[model samples]
Target: MAREGRQWSDFEIAVSDYLTTLREKAGEPSYRRLAELTGIKFSRLRDIFTKQNGTPTLQEFIDLCLTFGKDPADVIYKIMKDLEAKGISLSNIPAQNDPADEANAALASADNGVDIDAWADRIKAEDSVHEEQP
Candidate 1:
């Protein structure tokens, strides 16, 4: 079961439902209040939970999960399992083939089997790149 198109995972659906429940419990306050509680910025919290632009950062996701009294790992695993059930591979995530992967490949190809120093340098470079991105 491998699907090509994007679809919400069971975890996503469940989280959405859980968010809705929390909203009701909190009397459906504005996203601003939700952000205040979840520690994500107002716009970012809205974007992930309401606007559906993209997934939230791990910290935001975990915070939101905790707000709903859900275990962060459990929720993440559920979402991943749900995605797999829908034919979506975890490898489909855009970061799967990031430059880190290339560096890992390079290390794997080292004549000495893997230059640790080179790998560390490559990882540092990638981290810098990540930091420089908006």
Candidate 2:
């Protein structure tokens, strides 16, 4: 269990160190360079990776990690452990089996004679339409 009033847990330290290694491997770029490449602003990136209080959205962290050719699971594990250390109950967290689940589900649905590809294409088209609205 984490001590009360600690700024960071062991997992947080590991995550920070992991991110540091990633940044170093990517030619030791500045925060601004990481932001430009990963679509995360410098301040927000600093807040997520360097600061302690604010929690990053899972998608943002996953994307940023992926942009550096790193594994997403490691980052997620670090976050999960941090939450655990804080005594947060995780009984309600949904299952996240694998990244290919969506595609696999689509294929499985098609096996039952459903037009999964058409549905996926429709979703893509609808997303494009929504993207154009702004």
Per-candidate TM equals 0.47, 0.47
Q: Write the per-residue lDDT of candidate 1 for residues 11-125, one digit (tens) a residue.
A: 5555666566666786777888877777778887766655365655667767877877779787666666667777766674443357888997786787576667898999999
lDDT of 2 by residue, 1-134 (tens): 75433465455555666777778787888879888888888887776667455555667767778988878997667667666788865566664578699788877876878587797999999999999996
Against the true structure, candidate 2 has what lDDT?
0.73
C-alpha positional error of residue 121 in candidate 2 after TM-score superposition, expressed in Å: 43
TM-score of candidate 1 on Cα atoms, chains taken together: 0.47
Best by lDDT: 2
Question: Model 2, stretches more than 4 Å misplaced?
Answer: 1-8, 74-134
Write down the lDDT that model 1 would get.
0.69
